[model samples]
Target: MKALVTTEDSGFGLRMADVPEPEPRPGQALVEVRAVAVNRGELSMMAMLPPGSQLGWDIAGTVLRPAADGSGPAAGTRVTGLADGAGWSELAAADTARLTPVPDDLDWTAATAIPVVGLTALYALRHAGLLLGRTVLVTGAGGGVGRMAVQLAAASGARVVAWVGSAERAKGLRELGAAAVSTYDAEETGPVDVLVDSVGGQVLNRAYRLVVPGGKVIVYGNTTRSELNLPVDWGHARPGVQLRYVHLFHELPAHPVTRDLGFLVQRVADGLLDPQVATVAPWTDAEPALRALAQRQVNGKVVLTI
Candidate 1:
């Protein structure tokens, strides 16, 4: 079986290599992957993982084999799932708990984009309590998760303020439900009820200050990979403010991954949600796709066809 493996030699730290096929456990299903989504998190993981380690999370494909425990979808079912670091392979084993069946009409690229990006936005907004008639600020709003966050927040009746890195990346965000789209230097005033920040560092520090009292700031991905330095008076000045760190694995048991995935897929089918695929290419072009993502050259999810 051929899979993308971490390697120091590649510019993006990933390269295709022949590896032994995965063996599914009793609670896992073997999926013949047709498409996979590349994410910024995977690039960060490559820095910590050893060479040759399989590193991918979002995958969409057909079930080659059902879970041995008879808990998941039947064989040959089309599905989109979260992989435990081996999704880049042609065949990857996914736990039944994380697999969600996709409609036959859904494109593979769109299906593969749901797992991480959609769930992150869904869960982050859920943590913010009621969004109706509130102001929501989404940092890194041009990215995949950010785009989803903007739409979901707006759908919940919140006034969404999107913060992107540049003007060029700000296109189409307003149509997706953002009330205002601002770049890094834009002067955005007024307080927000909730903040969804993926671009860490200075953006996070600035956004946290914008959250009104009793508001929440949900931190998911630190794309900038910089240390956070908040004001020393944070505890005293902001009495009811809350800061949360959300990771999908940590929150997986709190809600059914399969159920959430189904909701996202159904939303896409109904045209209520957009996957926002920016690049679609064969797996042979993984390096360029990853590089583009890493460099912020693309504004949405990059799909690699297996």
Candidate 2:
């Protein structure tokens, strides 16, 4: 088996190497990975892991073996899942609860884009409660999660406003159902019913004020990695406003991963949702794609075909 593992190298911090095949537990299934998606979370995890550590989450593939407990899909079924790690490999042992059958209509590369970003956006929006006829603003609207958030929010009948870091990233958001797309520094005159902030720091500071009275703010990721300083009187002055930070894994226990993935995959199959892939390259090209993602050069998910 071969996998992309963390390394001490100064470049992408990852390299492909032969590794032992994973042994699926009773509640896990062995999947033959066809593709994987690059996410900021895995890249951030790279710095904390020792050399040779397996790091990956999103995977799309076929089930080589069903779980011993007879919980997961049958063998040979096409599936996409969120693995704890070792997903960027020939095979991965994924929990049955985290795995979902990938519809034949959904391409493997597109299926790879579903788990992390799609699930995160779904969960974040779920935390926002009702979105019908309300305004929902998404910051970092260029990235994978942000793009998915925009489409999902719009589909929920919310008036979507997407905020990106660059004008180049703002392209196609309107077509994807955003009412308006603005750059981070652009002035937004209207208040929103819900604010999904992925870019923290100054972007968050400003967006925080845009939430109308009784609105909700869901903070999932801080791509900017800067401190958030809110005025002391800000919270006091905003009545019924709520601020919530969603950790996908923490929320997963309450939300069925398979059910959510089924909905997303169906939407994609039905042409209601877009995976928004920025690039699809061989697994060997992962380093460059990952670099582009880290630099915020890509507008959406970077998929690596195995």
lDDT by residue (155-249, candidate 2, tens digit) is 99999999998899997899999999888643663788899998999888888777777889999988878887666666776888888899888
- How much RMSD separates candidate 1 from the native structure? 1.4
Best by TM-score: 2
TM-score of 2: 0.97
Q: Return the clash pairs for model 1, or none.
A: none
Stretch of 10 with least lDDT, candidate 2: 183-192
lDDT by residue (1-306, candidate 1, tens digit) is: 999898989777888999999999999999999999988888788899999999889999999999999999999999998987799999999999999999988989999998999998999899999999999999999999999999999999999999998998898899999999888543564688898998999988887777777888899988888897677776667788899999877888899899989999989988999989999999988778888898998889999999
Clashes of each: 0, 0
Look at candidate 2 and give me any clashing residue pairs.
none
